[model samples]
Every structure is written in structure tokens, then in C-alpha cells.
Target: MRIISGKYAKRNLFTLKSQKTRPTSDKVKESLFNSLGQFFAGGQVLDLYGGSGALGIEAVSRGCDHAVLNDVSRAAVAIIKKNVALTKEADRFDVTNMPAKVALKVLAQKGRKFDLVFLDPPYAKQQMVKDMTAMKQLDLLNDGALVVAETDDQTDLPAIAGFDLLKEHHLGKTLVRFYRKAAE
Candidate 1:
């Protein structure tokens, strides 16, 4: 896979060959970024199910200040680190090898907050709503934070109380939903 735009545009990224991780396709990534304004002025990003760190890295390339990429697998973590190194901006990234929930709690403890978040957990074990709720409880999301969730078309993600659906699109079998947290 490769970064779609910004400073790191066209940079190559390696993905695990294992079936455990499903990397976002270039088409979806590009379209998603376009929908999110293509670039950021300055803000942090959280790639909760980071995989190869494509989503978070892309955000950084497009101008977000920093990114934290977290995944549960060692192989995925290694791939993320390699991809971050490829950008030659390793200082702008933080990689964690842990479950999504655990990583969220740790970030919350550090008073970390994000302006953007990418959630692409394994389709078989999707817990997006639960995770979003936890993020809300932990105050890990900045007011009006944007959240993008990629999942199978069969999955229907509802608009929770604190978040409003911004956009929803389907690219073949993949469904992408963008939500904006209420500015409280």
C-alpha cells in the first residue's frame, strides 16, 4: 500500500501477509480523505486498529501534527514501525502493540485527545460502538473530533447520542462512516 496524498504521498507501505489484518484499499483511503477535507491544519490522530499504520500516517502526511498507531499483533506493530520509518518522520508517530481498548485507556490516562480517529478493526470482531462509547467516557476525543469507521457493508453503525453521522459511503463490500462528536 502507499500514502495517497500530502508530503508522504506515494510513499510505499508494507502490510502483513497474514489474514489477521485487512488493510484499507487505496481507493477507499483516497475517497475517505477527500471527504474529510483532504488535509488538516494541525491536530493529533489515533489509528486504533492501526495495522500497517496507513490511515494514521496518511493523516500526518496530510498535515495533522502527530499520530498514534495501535494494534494488538506484534507483526502488525512491526509493520507499522517500518512504515513510519519509511516516512522519515518517526518523531511524529507513536506505535503501540496492544488491544484497542487497552490502548485507549492508556492514552486517556495520559490525557491524550485526538482530532481524528480511524477504526478498522477486524470485521469478525467489530465493536465500534462499544469502543466509541469508551472513548467518549475517557474524554479521549476532542470536541467535534472526527471519527472514521471502516467495516463490512452488513454492519450498520448507528449514530450514538454524542456523535452525529457526517457521511456514509459504500465502496464495494466495504462501508465507511464518518462521525463528528458533538462540541460540548
Candidate 2:
């Protein structure tokens, strides 16, 4: 769709026409950022299931300094590159085509730490808890980082040790959950 706010507000983006990926809707994206307060100061963002790179790009638009958009599909990664290029600040983005776990490990090896993370896997393939645990173990999250999880309403994410449930928003069939990592 398009960016809802910030520098790229209302800018149209590219999306995959495949049924394999679902882009977050503008309404849900708005509500999601609203819960975190409008724009951010500066931070790193990660979208492991980078469908069209929309979520990560949106975060950059809303003040995050950098974003890493990773997808298992090369096609999605290509679209992610195209969308990031549209920002005209290509240096702000890093696109990788790999399995989510591999990307996480690679980022960890590179000593990357993120302030914001978006976990919006395919509705039926959600593994948020496991993913969060991996991130925690990989030391990829900054203290007090925020993790936004978008899933089908049927998916209920439980409380993990290092994170506190911040809020939840139910928008029709979709459920968005926010969690803050406990400072170590």
C-alpha cells in the first residue's frame, strides 16, 4: 500500500502479488505505531518476514535510522530492494534473502542490535515466541526494545521471561500485540 506517516507519508510502495505474502494494511499499521506513540527518535528496525519491506520501510519513514528487511523468498527480497530504493535513501536499508533464523544469526554475528522489531509472519506460519527467544539468545535486541507482533486473531502469544506485554489491538481478523523487552 503506502506509508501512513513521516517523511514517506502517503508514498505508494511495491507489493508482491503472490498469495504467499500479506502486506500489513494501512489501518493496522497506523494503529500499531499509534500504540508506540507516533514517530520515533532514532533506532534500528527489523522485519524478518519482509513482505514488500513495507513494515521496515514504514519504520524508517517514522524516524528509525535503519532497517533490516529479510525474507526467505528471493522474489520478496527483490521487491524489498525496489521499495527501499523508492525511499531514495538506499543506505538506510539492508535487504537479505534467507530463512528468518539464518538472518537473525547473521545479524547477531555482525553485532547488530535493534531497538524495534516487527514480527508479522504469514498468518498460518506464526512463530513469534520462538522467534523472540532466538533473538534474545542471539543478543540482537537492545534493552527495552519494542517488539510488535501482528497475527491472526486466533493466535495468542504468551508472556516470555524477558518481555512484558505492553498492549493489544484487535482490528477485525488481525491482532497486533506489543511487548517491551525487560532491560538486562
Q: Which candidate achieves the best lDDT against the true structure?
A: 1
Judge candidate 1 against the unseen true structure and give its global Cα lDDT, from 0 to 1.
0.92
TM-score attained by model 1: 0.97
Candidate 2 error regions (>4 Å): 123-126
Superposing all C-alpha atoms, what RMSD in Å does each candidate have to the true structure?
Answer: 1.2, 1.3
Would you list the clashing residue pairs of candidate 1? none
In the range 78-125, model 2's lDDT, one tens digit per residue, is: 999999988999999999999988999999999999999999876433
Worst 10 residues of 1 by lDDT: 121-130
lDDT for each residue of candidate 1 in 1-184, tens digit (9 for 90 to 100): 8998999999999999998888999999999999899989999999999999999999999999999999999999999999999999899999999888899999999999999999998853248888888899999999889989999899876667678887899999989998999877
Q: Report lDDT (CA) for all predictions.
A: 0.92, 0.89
Q: List ranges where model 1 is wrong by over 4 Å.
A: 123-126
